[model samples]
Target: MSSGGFHVHGPHDHAVEHAAQGHGHGDDHAASHGSEGGGSSMSKIAMFTAIVATVGAIFAYMGGATQANAGLLKNDAAIKKTEASNQWNYFQSKSTKQSLAELARDLAPEDRKAAYQAKVDRYESEKNEIKVAAEKLEADSHKFDRQSEEQMHQHHRWAQATTALQVAIALAAIALLTKKKWLEYGMYGVAGIGIAVGALATLHI
Candidate 1:
């Protein structure tokens, strides 16, 4: 009787131990699955952030290029304006000489009047040529001014786009740190605005 009881008790103890080990294994597997899920989520976030960063860099470069172009145009406009002013001054000087020639012709003695009249005619013709040249320079100056203004407007658009992209990058970083879905959506929205502005800049709108 004692030998039979020991055999039965041994089998019962083995069964309980096996059950406990199985339970522990199940818990470990569940924990491992949880960790894998979390890691996958983090990997996805990192990939999205990398994509946004690349786009942001492109936007920044475009903005810089636009600003450089605007500066160049502004300088050109200023130079043209200076040239126009110089031409106008020259026009004024020619007008003064023409007036002086006319006055001299009116007051000269009758014998010398013909020579002074010839001087007056030459001065008038030169003055008309100078006026036409001065007007052309002023028109050129105005054309440059319009082009510079257009470029400046484009620069402003590019700058706005760059700013929006920067904000989106910051938001993406925040979303990664916090693991918030809503923040990620917000980041996308800002990035969309940036892309739209960049497109508009390219169109010169």
Candidate 2:
């Protein structure tokens, strides 16, 4: 018991203090362990996010490059087509000149008929030459068109791969926020899918 300046403690009070001290130590130990685990999880998520972003950037760049190449090839096809049209026009002009020479031969006097016939023969040869050139130009135009189509197809694949990677990154952000074990597993699975798609792109599938 406590009088004027003296204080007294009962057995029950002492027991209560001991129990509180024990609980305090146990809580501190658990908290410290939990903080270490959370730090590790954060580091893992951050590193994964960075890697996925870098991969996505590379995919985006490849997609743009393929698209540009396709456009250039298509332009080449158009230019070739124009050149072929010009050649066909030239061939037509030669045919007209040949027809005129043939008509003159038919109506000319016997003495002058030979000269007109010679002109007709020369015009026929010129027409044949023009026809060959026009055909060659058309073939070149077709080749360019085929090449352009292939490039466009490749660009589409790259775009698809890039999209998958972006989705994976979004999932990673969600997992990081939630800190759920299932979410972490989901994040990994999505990341794997994204990488597989990227491989398909590289293979030109």
Candidate 3:
């Protein structure tokens, strides 16, 4: 029952959102100084931050979505497992009936023997059917569990990508404030790393 809204649920998601918003206007103060080259640099960094922020937002949304999917799928797994248990219980009951019928067949008088043997045969057939159903349910449960685990892994990748993007945004903000060329380089490097991580997430690596 996951919906379309991308609410910031994680602490890291909040941080990325805040960083994204703050950096969009970060160059304003730097621009007021009116150094032409510096102004251009500040503007470019601001734009970079904006783009990274957009990517981070996407990553955050994906993280939330995958997390929700993981939970839902895990619930499905649990439900299936419970159903499998019930089937097993049913199988056990049928087994008990079969045992009782077998005993009756052995102990019954000659005239009644055919009736008890027929009951025993019917119970055995019913037990086989229940066993097949129980095994199928157990297999289904395992499949759901595996799918849930994969979704959780994807969620972690998205979170990591978002975090990296947030760091890049932070660097852009600092570089904008200080007008340091090395910090700008650092910002670019971190931004590249963030995008690379996002690619990994996209590939589900």
Candidate 4:
């Protein structure tokens, strides 16, 4: 307080002040490192989530396509079945006409008998042709039914894969929050299963 009319700190006070500043700097450095570490972990989790989301979207699209195909095949099968039934009805109508024609031939005069017989023969031929067409339509309907069932199975597999991927994404979020390595590993395992199922669906298994 002498020459410049200012108060001066002693050596001990200066030392104490320097120690306090050192402690503050140490705390700041540690806080910075912690923040950096947390940010890195969050980035890693975000990257993994992005990958899962991309894959899940692909699987969901595939599932929708398969389901639509199945519906189309089912509709085709229904159409074919209706066509086959119509053909069978036509055959039955021809049978009824043939029966009436045969009865008329038996009851007709000798001069008209040949005409009625010709009508009966024509009806028989038409009935045979209708039977063939109806059988073919039934076969086609069965084929369509089988195809629809196969597509539905593929759709189910895709659905399962998509669900598994969603669960994995949720688990990954939990792992990020809790910082648990085991949870992270479990997420990877579920994601692997989802991928495997998706591959199976692609192969139509």
Candidate 5:
């Protein structure tokens, strides 16, 4: 029937084709593995970005609080210094007036006595004014100190909060990188502790 012995694709050839098709499924599995690897990389980057932002926010808050606290402290010191200066001025003026009155009393004639009395009256008036000014200064200084102290306490709280936030962000980042469930929960727990501390401090203040 055939001109010579020759090979032809028949049922056996079809079986070989089926084997090739089954082997090709490996390529699909490999592609799926590649896709999963890419997804992992993307997820890692997202986690990193979130962690960095949280930490950055904490640092920013800390910086602001530091500046506020320093300014308040400086203000308190300045007010105290000014109050001291006012007190010194008042004391000096009173002492000078007293010395002058004593001198006038010691060396006075009848006509000069009237003039000396007038001088004493003027000095007394000036002394009263000085006393009033000193009292006002003292009051203002105390007010300034109280306000500054409050501001300092507020800033301190802000700093503490920022520090706590930073710690939480760092822990979260580590947990995500490591894919550890315990670490993730631990981060939240630590953050809660910080909040409690802040609350207590606020209550005390």
Candidate 6:
């Protein structure tokens, strides 16, 4: 014991020191546990984000495939339409030539065999005309087929672009889960570029 409102203890005061040490150790342990929990939460967030991004990428690929198939179908339809038109034109031209030949033969009767022979020659000439027209139309149809194939190819490119956009968007969303502002920002930039590409591709379609 001491004067001036101060007290001094012997060996028992060591108990106070011991209690303080235990409290401090408890506090440190609690703090460590909390820190570990926070780290685990962050890891979970990263894992979730990754899963979402992967799933989105898969869906985007599927969508791209479907869109490409649709474009191919459209091209096929266009080609068929053009082919049908050409066939109709060829039939009409052939019929017209045959009808004209019959009319010319009916107009003459005195020299019947000579007239018939002339009609045969005219029919042969008309056949040549039909053949030439059919050949030209065939060539035109082939050209159209090539154009349709090109169009389909353009559509496939568009699909790939859109798919990339979808994957980028998903990855951006995942970045947000980490609460890393910089990562999120980078993802946003990637997503924007993907969207621009998709838009350009769609325009071509």
Worst 10 residues of 6 by lDDT: 51-60
Cα RMSD, model 1: 3.5
User: lDDT scores for all predictions?
Assistant: 0.81, 0.88, 0.89, 0.96, 0.69, 0.63
Cα-lDDT of candidate 5: 0.69
Query: By the TM-score metric, which is better: model 1 or model 2?
Result: 2
Summing lDDT over every window of 10 consecutive residues in candidate 1, give the lowest-scoring window. Answer: 1-10
Q: What is the lDDT, from 0 to 100, of the residue 42 in candidate 4? A: 78
Q: Which number leads on lDDT?
A: 4
Candidate 6 error regions (>4 Å):
2-19, 101-205
Candidate order, lDDT descending: 4, 3, 2, 1, 5, 6
TM-score on alpha carbons, each prediction = 0.80, 0.82, 0.82, 0.81, 0.62, 0.45
- Lowest lDDT sum, 10 consecutive residues, model 4, at 1-10
Expressed as tens digits, the lDDT of each residue in 1-205 for candidate 5 is: 2346875668888899999888799888899998897568547545754764565475457547655765776687677668767776877887698779868966997768777777777777777777777777766777776666766666666567667766777777787678676766777776776666556445644
For residues 83-143, what per-residue lDDT tens digits would candidate 3 score against the true structure? 9999999999988988898888899999999999999889889888989999999999999
lDDT (Cα, tens digit) per residue for candidate 2, span 47-162: 98899899889988998998999999999999989999999999999889889999999999999999999999998898889889889989999999998898888888888878
TM-score of model number 5: 0.62
User: Compared with the true structure, what per-residue lDDT tens digits does model 6 show for residues 128-175?
Assistant: 776676666666656656665655565565556555556555655565
Model 4 C-alpha lDDT per residue in residues 1-205, reported as the tens digit of each score? 3458877888998999999999999999999998998888778878989999999999999999999999999999999999999999999999999999999999999999999999999999999999999999999999999999999999999999999999999999999889888898999899999999999998988
Which stretches of model 4 miss by more than 4 angstroms?
1-41
Candidate 4 local Cα displacement, residue 120, angstroms: 1.2
Against the true structure, candidate 3 reaches a TM-score of: 0.82
